[model samples]
Target: MVEIAMRSYWNEGPTEVSLNGLCQRAGVSKPSVYREFGNEDGLTHAALENYGHCVLAKVLEILAGEDIFAGKIRKIAYLAAEDGAHESGCLFVKMRTAKNQMGEKTQILIAAMASMAVDAYANLLIEGRETGEWPGNIPVKLGAAYLHAQIGLALDQRARGEDPRVVLALALCVLGLTDAQSEIA
Candidate 1:
Protein backbone atom coordinates (compact mmCIF):
# COMPACT_ATOMS: atom_id res chain seq x y z
CA MET A 1 0.00 0.00 0.00
CA VAL A 2 2.80 2.37 0.87
CA GLU A 3 4.65 1.31 -2.21
CA ILE A 4 1.54 1.88 -4.27
CA ALA A 5 1.35 5.44 -3.03
CA MET A 6 5.04 5.89 -3.67
CA ARG A 7 4.65 4.65 -7.24
CA SER A 8 1.72 6.98 -7.66
CA TYR A 9 3.96 9.87 -6.67
CA TRP A 10 6.69 8.67 -9.03
CA ASN A 11 4.49 7.86 -12.01
CA GLU A 12 1.84 10.52 -11.67
CA GLY A 13 3.73 13.15 -9.69
CA PRO A 14 2.18 15.11 -6.79
CA THR A 15 -0.87 16.36 -8.64
CA GLU A 16 -2.45 12.92 -9.04
CA VAL A 17 -2.11 11.53 -5.55
CA SER A 18 -4.82 11.05 -2.92
CA LEU A 19 -5.35 8.72 0.01
CA ASN A 20 -8.55 7.51 -1.60
CA GLY A 21 -6.73 6.72 -4.81
CA LEU A 22 -3.96 4.94 -2.97
CA CYS A 23 -6.40 2.86 -0.95
CA GLN A 24 -8.31 1.92 -4.06
CA ARG A 25 -5.16 1.04 -5.95
CA ALA A 26 -3.73 -0.89 -3.04
CA GLY A 27 -7.00 -2.66 -2.18
CA VAL A 28 -6.78 -1.61 1.43
CA SER A 29 -9.36 0.22 3.50
CA LYS A 30 -8.99 3.91 4.32
CA PRO A 31 -8.93 3.16 8.03
CA SER A 32 -6.25 0.57 7.54
CA VAL A 33 -4.17 3.01 5.60
CA TYR A 34 -4.44 5.63 8.29
CA ARG A 35 -3.79 3.11 11.01
CA GLU A 36 -0.67 1.87 9.35
CA PHE A 37 0.83 5.17 8.24
CA GLY A 38 -0.77 7.81 10.51
CA ASN A 39 -1.58 10.32 7.72
CA GLU A 40 -0.68 11.22 4.15
CA ASP A 41 2.68 12.60 5.18
CA GLY A 42 3.47 9.51 7.19
CA LEU A 43 2.30 7.29 4.38
CA THR A 44 4.44 9.06 1.82
CA HIS A 45 7.40 8.95 4.15
CA ALA A 46 6.97 5.22 4.66
CA ALA A 47 6.53 4.82 0.96
CA LEU A 48 9.82 6.50 0.19
CA GLU A 49 11.52 4.41 2.85
CA ASN A 50 10.05 1.24 1.39
CA TYR A 51 11.06 2.25 -2.10
CA GLY A 52 14.59 3.13 -1.02
CA HIS A 53 15.10 -0.28 0.59
CA CYS A 54 13.05 -2.73 -1.45
CA VAL A 55 13.00 -1.41 -5.01
CA LEU A 56 16.40 0.27 -4.86
CA ALA A 57 18.48 -2.37 -3.08
CA LYS A 58 19.85 -3.94 -6.24
CA VAL A 59 20.56 -0.52 -7.73
CA LEU A 60 22.34 0.49 -4.55
CA GLU A 61 24.43 -2.68 -4.77
CA ILE A 62 25.49 -1.84 -8.30
CA LEU A 63 26.35 1.68 -7.21
CA ALA A 64 28.53 0.34 -4.41
CA GLY A 65 30.17 -2.33 -6.59
CA GLU A 66 33.74 -2.52 -7.83
CA ASP A 67 32.77 -1.37 -11.31
CA ILE A 68 33.85 2.05 -12.52
CA PHE A 69 31.50 4.82 -13.64
CA ALA A 70 31.52 3.65 -17.25
CA GLY A 71 30.59 0.12 -16.29
CA LYS A 72 27.97 1.38 -13.87
CA ILE A 73 26.56 3.85 -16.37
CA ARG A 74 26.46 1.25 -19.12
CA LYS A 75 24.78 -1.27 -16.86
CA ILE A 76 22.08 1.24 -15.88
CA ALA A 77 21.72 2.21 -19.52
CA TYR A 78 21.10 -1.42 -20.41
CA LEU A 79 18.55 -1.65 -17.64
CA ALA A 80 16.93 1.42 -19.10
CA ALA A 81 16.92 -0.33 -22.46
CA GLU A 82 14.85 -3.08 -20.89
CA ASP A 83 11.15 -2.34 -21.02
CA GLY A 84 10.07 -2.99 -17.45
CA ALA A 85 13.04 -1.36 -15.77
CA HIS A 86 12.64 1.75 -17.84
CA GLU A 87 9.00 2.11 -16.87
CA SER A 88 9.47 1.55 -13.14
CA GLY A 89 11.03 5.03 -12.80
CA CYS A 90 13.79 6.24 -10.48
CA LEU A 91 12.98 7.25 -6.89
CA PHE A 92 15.73 9.79 -6.38
CA VAL A 93 14.99 11.52 -9.63
CA LYS A 94 11.28 11.59 -8.94
CA MET A 95 11.61 12.76 -5.37
CA ARG A 96 14.30 15.31 -6.04
CA THR A 97 12.32 16.73 -8.90
CA ALA A 98 9.20 16.96 -6.76
CA LYS A 99 10.64 17.92 -3.39
CA ASN A 100 9.07 21.35 -3.25
CA GLN A 101 5.59 19.84 -3.50
CA MET A 102 6.09 17.27 -0.77
CA GLY A 103 5.51 17.63 2.93
CA GLU A 104 8.33 18.72 5.25
CA LYS A 105 9.22 15.21 6.42
CA THR A 106 9.07 13.87 2.89
CA GLN A 107 11.22 16.76 1.72
CA ILE A 108 13.78 15.97 4.41
CA LEU A 109 13.81 12.33 3.39
CA ILE A 110 14.44 13.30 -0.19
CA ALA A 111 17.36 15.42 0.89
CA ALA A 112 18.82 12.53 2.85
CA MET A 113 18.38 10.20 -0.07
CA ALA A 114 19.93 12.64 -2.54
CA SER A 115 22.84 13.42 -0.23
CA MET A 116 23.56 9.72 0.30
CA ALA A 117 23.52 9.10 -3.44
CA VAL A 118 25.88 12.01 -4.10
CA ASP A 119 28.26 10.76 -1.42
CA ALA A 120 28.26 7.30 -2.90
CA TYR A 121 28.77 8.72 -6.38
CA ALA A 122 31.65 10.87 -5.15
CA ASN A 123 33.26 7.88 -3.49
CA LEU A 124 32.92 5.90 -6.70
CA LEU A 125 34.50 8.79 -8.60
CA ILE A 126 37.42 8.78 -6.21
CA GLU A 127 37.86 5.04 -6.63
CA GLY A 128 37.67 5.31 -10.40
CA ARG A 129 40.28 8.04 -10.38
CA GLU A 130 42.59 5.86 -8.29
CA THR A 131 42.28 3.12 -10.90
CA GLY A 132 42.72 5.49 -13.89
CA GLU A 133 39.21 4.71 -15.05
CA TRP A 134 37.73 8.12 -14.20
CA PRO A 135 39.07 11.42 -15.59
CA GLY A 136 42.30 12.57 -14.00
CA ASN A 137 42.18 16.20 -15.01
CA ILE A 138 38.94 16.96 -13.21
CA PRO A 139 38.64 17.11 -9.46
CA VAL A 140 36.91 14.08 -7.95
CA LYS A 141 34.02 16.24 -6.73
CA LEU A 142 33.49 17.78 -10.15
CA GLY A 143 33.71 14.41 -11.86
CA ALA A 144 31.23 12.98 -9.41
CA ALA A 145 28.85 15.89 -9.99
CA TYR A 146 29.19 15.46 -13.76
CA LEU A 147 28.49 11.76 -13.59
CA HIS A 148 25.55 12.36 -11.26
CA ALA A 149 24.16 15.03 -13.54
CA GLN A 150 24.43 12.77 -16.56
CA ILE A 151 22.54 10.01 -14.78
CA GLY A 152 19.91 12.45 -13.55
CA LEU A 153 19.45 13.64 -17.12
CA ALA A 154 19.19 10.10 -18.41
CA LEU A 155 16.57 9.22 -15.85
CA ASP A 156 14.70 12.42 -16.53
CA GLN A 157 14.62 11.59 -20.21
CA ARG A 158 13.52 8.09 -19.38
CA ALA A 159 10.68 9.52 -17.30
CA ARG A 160 9.73 11.89 -20.11
CA GLY A 161 9.10 9.01 -22.54
CA GLU A 162 12.38 9.25 -24.43
CA ASP A 163 13.95 6.07 -25.74
CA PRO A 164 15.96 4.80 -22.80
CA ARG A 165 18.72 3.59 -25.09
CA VAL A 166 19.15 6.97 -26.69
CA VAL A 167 18.98 8.75 -23.36
CA LEU A 168 21.69 6.48 -21.97
CA ALA A 169 23.81 6.76 -25.06
CA LEU A 170 23.74 10.53 -24.76
CA ALA A 171 24.73 10.29 -21.12
CA LEU A 172 27.56 7.89 -21.94
CA CYS A 173 28.80 10.27 -24.59
CA VAL A 174 28.75 13.05 -21.99
CA LEU A 175 30.83 10.81 -19.70
CA GLY A 176 33.36 10.04 -22.49
CA LEU A 177 32.67 6.29 -22.55
CA THR A 178 32.64 4.54 -25.89
CA ASP A 179 30.41 1.55 -26.47
CA ALA A 180 33.53 -0.59 -26.70
CA GLN A 181 34.65 0.50 -23.23
CA SER A 182 31.21 0.03 -21.67
CA GLU A 183 31.18 -3.77 -21.86
CA ILE A 184 28.94 -4.02 -18.83
CA ALA A 185 26.07 -3.70 -21.26
Candidate 2:
Protein backbone atom coordinates (compact mmCIF):
# COMPACT_ATOMS: atom_id res chain seq x y z
CA MET A 1 0.00 0.00 0.00
CA VAL A 2 2.78 2.43 0.82
CA GLU A 3 4.56 1.53 -2.41
CA ILE A 4 1.38 2.07 -4.39
CA ALA A 5 0.79 5.40 -2.72
CA MET A 6 4.42 6.45 -3.31
CA ARG A 7 4.28 5.59 -7.00
CA SER A 8 0.95 7.36 -7.44
CA TYR A 9 2.10 10.44 -5.57
CA TRP A 10 5.37 10.42 -7.51
CA ASN A 11 3.90 10.05 -10.97
CA GLU A 12 0.81 12.13 -10.38
CA GLY A 13 1.11 15.35 -8.44
CA PRO A 14 0.46 14.85 -4.76
CA THR A 15 -2.40 17.34 -4.88
CA GLU A 16 -3.89 15.51 -7.84
CA VAL A 17 -4.06 12.09 -6.16
CA SER A 18 -6.86 11.23 -3.79
CA LEU A 19 -6.86 8.94 -0.74
CA ASN A 20 -9.78 6.94 -2.13
CA GLY A 21 -7.97 6.48 -5.41
CA LEU A 22 -4.90 5.30 -3.58
CA CYS A 23 -6.95 2.84 -1.55
CA GLN A 24 -8.56 1.46 -4.70
CA ARG A 25 -5.28 1.12 -6.54
CA ALA A 26 -3.57 -0.46 -3.59
CA GLY A 27 -6.44 -2.96 -3.07
CA VAL A 28 -7.00 -1.76 0.44
CA SER A 29 -9.87 -0.33 2.40
CA LYS A 30 -10.15 3.35 3.24
CA PRO A 31 -10.42 2.55 6.91
CA SER A 32 -7.35 0.37 6.68
CA VAL A 33 -5.38 3.14 5.05
CA TYR A 34 -6.64 5.67 7.57
CA ARG A 35 -5.97 3.31 10.42
CA GLU A 36 -2.44 2.78 9.17
CA PHE A 37 -1.67 6.34 8.16
CA GLY A 38 -4.05 8.36 10.29
CA ASN A 39 -5.11 10.77 7.49
CA GLU A 40 -4.23 12.03 4.03
CA ASP A 41 -1.49 14.19 5.47
CA GLY A 42 -0.06 11.27 7.33
CA LEU A 43 -0.19 9.13 4.22
CA THR A 44 1.47 11.80 2.12
CA HIS A 45 4.12 12.39 4.75
CA ALA A 46 4.83 8.70 4.97
CA ALA A 47 5.07 8.45 1.19
CA LEU A 48 7.51 11.37 1.17
CA GLU A 49 9.59 9.68 3.82
CA ASN A 50 9.59 6.50 1.75
CA TYR A 51 10.65 8.47 -1.32
CA GLY A 52 13.45 10.10 0.68
CA HIS A 53 14.70 6.72 1.73
CA CYS A 54 14.30 4.93 -1.62
CA VAL A 55 15.15 7.59 -4.20
CA LEU A 56 16.67 10.61 -2.50
CA ALA A 57 19.07 8.40 -0.57
CA LYS A 58 20.93 7.58 -3.78
CA VAL A 59 21.34 11.25 -4.62
CA LEU A 60 22.58 11.95 -1.13
CA GLU A 61 24.97 9.06 -1.50
CA ILE A 62 26.32 10.59 -4.69
CA LEU A 63 26.86 13.90 -2.95
CA ALA A 64 28.66 12.09 -0.18
CA GLY A 65 30.90 10.22 -2.61
CA GLU A 66 34.63 10.72 -3.22
CA ASP A 67 33.98 11.88 -6.78
CA ILE A 68 34.93 15.41 -7.74
CA PHE A 69 32.28 18.08 -7.46
CA ALA A 70 31.69 18.33 -11.20
CA GLY A 71 31.25 14.60 -11.45
CA LYS A 72 28.61 14.66 -8.73
CA ILE A 73 26.78 17.52 -10.43
CA ARG A 74 26.80 15.76 -13.78
CA LYS A 75 25.56 12.54 -12.22
CA ILE A 76 22.73 14.39 -10.51
CA ALA A 77 21.84 16.17 -13.75
CA TYR A 78 21.74 12.86 -15.56
CA LEU A 79 19.58 11.39 -12.84
CA ALA A 80 17.17 14.25 -13.20
CA ALA A 81 17.19 13.88 -16.96
CA GLU A 82 16.55 10.16 -16.88
CA ASP A 83 14.17 10.28 -13.91
CA GLY A 84 13.92 6.49 -14.18
CA ALA A 85 10.39 5.04 -14.82
CA HIS A 86 8.54 7.96 -13.29
CA GLU A 87 8.63 10.28 -16.29
CA SER A 88 6.13 12.76 -14.89
CA GLY A 89 8.68 14.34 -12.45
CA CYS A 90 10.37 13.98 -9.15
CA LEU A 91 8.07 13.23 -6.21
CA PHE A 92 10.06 15.63 -4.05
CA VAL A 93 9.86 18.30 -6.72
CA LYS A 94 6.15 17.69 -7.18
CA MET A 95 5.54 17.78 -3.45
CA ARG A 96 7.61 20.94 -3.08
CA THR A 97 5.73 22.57 -5.94
CA ALA A 98 2.35 21.78 -4.39
CA LYS A 99 3.50 22.57 -0.88
CA ASN A 100 0.78 25.14 -0.27
CA GLN A 101 -1.94 22.58 -0.80
CA MET A 102 -0.31 19.88 1.31
CA GLY A 103 -1.09 19.15 4.95
CA GLU A 104 1.19 20.37 7.73
CA LYS A 105 3.06 17.11 8.05
CA THR A 106 3.80 16.98 4.34
CA GLN A 107 4.75 20.65 4.25
CA ILE A 108 7.13 20.27 7.17
CA LEU A 109 8.71 17.25 5.58
CA ILE A 110 9.17 19.11 2.33
CA ALA A 111 10.86 22.04 4.05
CA ALA A 112 13.12 19.71 5.98
CA MET A 113 14.05 17.84 2.82
CA ALA A 114 14.79 21.09 1.05
CA SER A 115 17.05 22.23 3.86
CA MET A 116 18.81 18.89 3.92
CA ALA A 117 19.45 19.03 0.18
CA VAL A 118 20.87 22.53 0.42
CA ASP A 119 23.12 21.50 3.27
CA ALA A 120 24.38 18.52 1.33
CA TYR A 121 25.08 20.74 -1.64
CA ALA A 122 26.92 23.19 0.60
CA ASN A 123 29.05 20.45 2.05
CA LEU A 124 29.90 19.19 -1.42
CA LEU A 125 30.98 22.66 -2.46
CA ILE A 126 33.17 22.95 0.57
CA GLU A 127 34.81 19.64 -0.25
CA GLY A 128 35.25 20.65 -3.87
CA ARG A 129 37.06 23.79 -2.80
CA GLU A 130 39.23 21.88 -0.36
CA THR A 131 40.22 19.37 -3.03
CA GLY A 132 40.66 22.04 -5.72
CA GLU A 133 38.31 20.16 -8.00
CA TRP A 134 36.15 23.21 -8.66
CA PRO A 135 37.13 26.87 -8.67
CA GLY A 136 36.00 28.82 -5.65
CA ASN A 137 35.03 32.07 -7.36
CA ILE A 138 31.54 31.79 -5.95
CA PRO A 139 31.11 31.64 -2.21
CA VAL A 140 30.37 28.12 -0.99
CA LYS A 141 27.04 29.05 0.54
CA LEU A 142 25.90 30.98 -2.55
CA GLY A 143 27.18 28.27 -4.89
CA ALA A 144 25.35 25.61 -2.94
CA ALA A 145 22.10 27.55 -3.11
CA TYR A 146 22.57 28.15 -6.81
CA LEU A 147 23.33 24.51 -7.53
CA HIS A 148 20.25 23.41 -5.59
CA ALA A 149 18.03 25.81 -7.52
CA GLN A 150 19.57 24.74 -10.81
CA ILE A 151 18.91 21.10 -10.04
CA GLY A 152 15.30 21.85 -9.15
CA LEU A 153 15.00 23.82 -12.37
CA ALA A 154 16.38 20.88 -14.32
CA LEU A 155 13.87 18.54 -12.71
CA ASP A 156 11.08 20.99 -13.44
CA GLN A 157 12.16 21.16 -17.08
CA ARG A 158 12.16 17.39 -17.28
CA ALA A 159 8.63 17.34 -15.83
CA ARG A 160 7.58 19.74 -18.60
CA GLY A 161 8.81 17.20 -21.20
CA GLU A 162 11.98 19.01 -22.18
CA ASP A 163 14.51 17.00 -24.14
CA PRO A 164 16.75 15.13 -21.69
CA ARG A 165 19.95 15.82 -23.65
CA VAL A 166 19.12 19.47 -23.86
CA VAL A 167 18.50 19.52 -20.13
CA LEU A 168 21.82 17.78 -19.54
CA ALA A 169 23.72 20.14 -21.78
CA LEU A 170 22.17 23.19 -20.18
CA ALA A 171 22.82 21.98 -16.68
CA LEU A 172 26.47 21.17 -17.40
CA CYS A 173 26.97 24.50 -19.07
CA VAL A 174 25.38 26.43 -16.24
CA LEU A 175 27.55 24.63 -13.71
CA GLY A 176 30.69 25.19 -15.82
CA LEU A 177 31.39 21.50 -15.76
CA THR A 178 34.38 21.49 -18.15
CA ASP A 179 33.45 19.91 -21.51
CA ALA A 180 31.06 17.48 -19.88
CA GLN A 181 28.38 18.08 -22.51
CA SER A 182 30.49 16.56 -25.26
CA GLU A 183 31.61 13.65 -23.12
CA ILE A 184 28.16 13.01 -21.69
CA ALA A 185 26.58 13.31 -25.12
Candidate 3:
Protein backbone atom coordinates (compact mmCIF):
# COMPACT_ATOMS: atom_id res chain seq x y z
CA MET A 1 0.00 0.00 0.00
CA VAL A 2 2.83 2.34 0.84
CA GLU A 3 4.58 1.32 -2.38
CA ILE A 4 1.43 1.99 -4.38
CA ALA A 5 0.98 5.39 -2.81
CA MET A 6 4.58 6.24 -3.48
CA ARG A 7 4.37 5.16 -7.12
CA SER A 8 1.22 7.21 -7.49
CA TYR A 9 2.91 10.27 -6.05
CA TRP A 10 6.01 9.69 -8.14
CA ASN A 11 4.10 9.31 -11.38
CA GLU A 12 1.81 12.19 -10.66
CA GLY A 13 3.44 14.85 -8.31
CA PRO A 14 2.73 15.11 -4.59
CA THR A 15 0.37 18.09 -4.90
CA GLU A 16 -1.79 16.12 -7.32
CA VAL A 17 -2.35 13.18 -4.97
CA SER A 18 -4.46 12.96 -1.82
CA LEU A 19 -4.66 10.37 0.96
CA ASN A 20 -8.16 9.38 -0.07
CA GLY A 21 -6.99 8.95 -3.64
CA LEU A 22 -4.11 6.74 -2.55
CA CYS A 23 -6.33 4.64 -0.32
CA GLN A 24 -8.74 4.12 -3.18
CA ARG A 25 -5.97 3.27 -5.63
CA ALA A 26 -4.24 0.99 -3.13
CA GLY A 27 -7.51 -0.58 -1.98
CA VAL A 28 -6.83 0.13 1.64
CA SER A 29 -8.63 2.01 4.40
CA LYS A 30 -7.46 5.48 5.47
CA PRO A 31 -6.55 4.22 8.93
CA SER A 32 -4.60 1.33 7.51
CA VAL A 33 -2.57 3.74 5.41
CA TYR A 34 -2.08 5.97 8.40
CA ARG A 35 -1.09 3.01 10.57
CA GLU A 36 1.61 2.04 8.09
CA PHE A 37 2.72 5.53 7.19
CA GLY A 38 1.89 8.32 9.59
CA ASN A 39 1.60 10.94 6.89
CA GLU A 40 2.16 11.71 3.25
CA ASP A 41 5.75 12.69 3.92
CA GLY A 42 6.38 9.32 5.53
CA LEU A 43 4.89 7.53 2.56
CA THR A 44 6.97 9.57 0.13
CA HIS A 45 10.19 8.80 2.00
CA ALA A 46 9.47 5.09 2.10
CA ALA A 47 8.64 5.16 -1.56
CA LEU A 48 11.87 6.96 -2.39
CA GLU A 49 13.84 4.35 -0.49
CA ASN A 50 12.00 1.54 -2.25
CA TYR A 51 12.53 3.13 -5.64
CA GLY A 52 16.21 3.72 -4.89
CA HIS A 53 16.74 0.06 -3.95
CA CYS A 54 14.99 -1.05 -7.12
CA VAL A 55 17.28 1.07 -9.30
CA LEU A 56 20.37 -0.10 -7.45
CA ALA A 57 19.31 -3.72 -7.85
CA LYS A 58 18.84 -3.31 -11.56
CA VAL A 59 22.25 -1.66 -11.94
CA LEU A 60 23.89 -4.42 -9.95
CA GLU A 61 22.17 -7.09 -12.00
CA ILE A 62 23.49 -5.57 -15.20
CA LEU A 63 26.97 -5.30 -13.77
CA ALA A 64 26.85 -8.91 -12.60
CA GLY A 65 26.07 -10.15 -16.09
CA GLU A 66 28.56 -12.04 -18.27
CA ASP A 67 29.56 -9.09 -20.42
CA ILE A 68 32.78 -7.19 -19.91
CA PHE A 69 32.73 -3.88 -18.05
CA ALA A 70 32.61 -1.81 -21.23
CA GLY A 71 29.74 -3.82 -22.62
CA LYS A 72 27.83 -3.71 -19.35
CA ILE A 73 28.35 0.02 -18.98
CA ARG A 74 27.18 0.54 -22.57
CA LYS A 75 24.03 -1.42 -21.89
CA ILE A 76 23.41 0.52 -18.67
CA ALA A 77 23.97 3.81 -20.47
CA TYR A 78 21.51 2.87 -23.20
CA LEU A 79 18.89 1.87 -20.67
CA ALA A 80 19.33 5.12 -18.72
CA ALA A 81 19.22 7.23 -21.88
CA GLU A 82 16.07 5.47 -22.99
CA ASP A 83 14.34 6.29 -19.73
CA GLY A 84 15.75 9.81 -19.33
CA ALA A 85 12.64 11.74 -20.28
CA HIS A 86 10.40 10.83 -17.38
CA GLU A 87 10.08 11.91 -13.74
CA SER A 88 12.89 14.43 -13.72
CA GLY A 89 15.23 11.95 -15.42
CA CYS A 90 15.00 8.90 -13.12
CA LEU A 91 13.51 7.88 -9.79
CA PHE A 92 16.90 8.19 -8.06
CA VAL A 93 17.41 11.60 -9.59
CA LYS A 94 13.95 12.63 -8.49
CA MET A 95 14.67 11.37 -4.98
CA ARG A 96 17.87 13.40 -4.88
CA THR A 97 15.93 16.52 -5.78
CA ALA A 98 13.26 15.71 -3.24
CA LYS A 99 15.84 15.10 -0.51
CA ASN A 100 16.40 18.83 -0.21
CA GLN A 101 12.76 19.31 0.75
CA MET A 102 12.55 16.26 2.97
CA GLY A 103 13.46 15.76 6.62
CA GLU A 104 17.01 14.93 7.72
CA LYS A 105 16.30 11.22 8.05
CA THR A 106 15.03 11.02 4.51
CA GLN A 107 17.98 13.08 3.33
CA ILE A 108 20.37 10.55 4.86
CA LEU A 109 18.61 7.70 3.08
CA ILE A 110 18.85 9.56 -0.20
CA ALA A 111 22.54 10.26 0.29
CA ALA A 112 23.23 6.61 1.05
CA MET A 113 21.38 5.54 -2.06
CA ALA A 114 23.42 7.95 -4.17
CA SER A 115 26.59 6.64 -2.58
CA MET A 116 25.68 3.08 -3.52
CA ALA A 117 25.35 4.09 -7.13
CA VAL A 118 28.71 5.85 -7.13
CA ASP A 119 30.39 2.89 -5.45
CA ALA A 120 28.95 0.48 -7.99
CA TYR A 121 30.38 2.54 -10.82
CA ALA A 122 33.73 2.75 -9.10
CA ASN A 123 33.88 -0.99 -8.57
CA LEU A 124 33.01 -1.62 -12.20
CA LEU A 125 35.79 0.69 -13.32
CA ILE A 126 38.24 -1.09 -11.06
CA GLU A 127 37.21 -4.41 -12.54
CA GLY A 128 37.56 -3.03 -16.03
CA ARG A 129 41.07 -1.81 -15.32
CA GLU A 130 42.10 -5.14 -13.80
CA THR A 131 40.82 -6.98 -16.85
CA GLY A 132 42.56 -4.66 -19.31
CA GLU A 133 39.20 -3.51 -20.68
CA TRP A 134 40.03 0.02 -19.54
CA PRO A 135 43.31 1.89 -19.28
CA GLY A 136 44.96 1.32 -15.93
CA ASN A 137 46.13 4.90 -15.85
CA ILE A 138 42.56 6.06 -15.30
CA PRO A 139 41.77 6.04 -11.60
CA VAL A 140 38.61 4.18 -10.62
CA LYS A 141 37.43 7.08 -8.51
CA LEU A 142 37.89 9.48 -11.40
CA GLY A 143 36.07 7.13 -13.75
CA ALA A 144 33.21 6.82 -11.28
CA ALA A 145 32.99 10.60 -10.99
CA TYR A 146 32.95 10.87 -14.78
CA LEU A 147 30.15 8.35 -15.06
CA HIS A 148 28.09 10.13 -12.39
CA ALA A 149 28.64 13.43 -14.14
CA GLN A 150 27.37 11.92 -17.38
CA ILE A 151 24.22 10.74 -15.61
CA GLY A 152 23.63 14.25 -14.27
CA LEU A 153 24.23 15.69 -17.73
CA ALA A 154 21.79 13.25 -19.28
CA LEU A 155 19.17 14.12 -16.67
CA ASP A 156 19.72 17.82 -17.20
CA GLN A 157 19.34 17.41 -20.96
CA ARG A 158 16.07 15.61 -20.46
CA ALA A 159 14.85 18.34 -18.11
CA ARG A 160 15.79 20.97 -20.70
CA GLY A 161 14.00 19.02 -23.49
CA GLU A 162 17.26 18.43 -25.33
CA ASP A 163 17.96 15.25 -27.28
CA PRO A 164 19.18 12.67 -24.77
CA ARG A 165 20.55 10.39 -27.48
CA VAL A 166 22.90 13.04 -28.82
CA VAL A 167 23.99 13.87 -25.32
CA LEU A 168 24.51 10.19 -24.57
CA ALA A 169 26.64 9.77 -27.66
CA LEU A 170 28.79 12.71 -26.70
CA ALA A 171 29.14 11.31 -23.20
CA LEU A 172 30.23 7.95 -24.56
CA CYS A 173 32.80 9.73 -26.69
CA VAL A 174 34.10 11.67 -23.73
CA LEU A 175 34.37 8.47 -21.70
CA GLY A 176 36.55 6.89 -24.42
CA LEU A 177 33.94 4.21 -25.00
CA THR A 178 33.32 5.24 -28.60
CA ASP A 179 35.39 4.45 -31.66
CA ALA A 180 34.95 4.39 -35.45
CA GLN A 181 34.24 0.67 -35.52
CA SER A 182 31.65 0.91 -32.77
CA GLU A 183 30.14 3.92 -34.52
CA ILE A 184 29.34 1.76 -37.56
CA ALA A 185 26.39 0.42 -35.63
Candidate with best TM-score: 2
Measured on C-alpha atoms, candidate 2 has an lDDT of 0.81
Per lDDT, the best of the predicted structures is 2
Tens digits of per-residue lDDT for model 3 on 1-185?
Answer: 76786577566644457778988998888887668778666776787777766655777788777888777877776666565335345655655665666656667777787777778888887887788776645577776777776776676566566656666666556656665115422
Pairs that collide, model 3: none
TM-score of every candidate relative to the true structure? 0.82, 0.89, 0.77
Q: What are the runs in model 3 whose C-alpha is more than 4 Å off?
A: 13-31, 83-88, 136-138, 155-161, 180-185
User: What are the per-residue Cα lDDT tens digits for candidate 2 across 30-136?
Assistant: 99988998988999999999999998898899999988877887787778778575367688988998899999999999999999999998898788778876666
- Which order, best to worst by lDDT? 2, 1, 3
Identify the superior model by lDDT, candidate 2 or candidate 3: 2
Q: Give the per-residue lDDT of model 1 (tens digit) for 16-47.
A: 67889888899999999879877777888888
Candidate 3's TM-score reads: 0.77
Candidate 3 minimal-lDDT segment of 10 residues? 176-185
After superposing candidate 1 on the true structure, give the runs of residues whose Cα lies further than 4 Å from its correct spot.
29-31, 81-83, 178-185
How far does residue 96 in candidate 3 sit from its true spot (Å)?
0.4
**Model 2, runs deviating above 4 Å:** 83-86, 164-176, 181-185
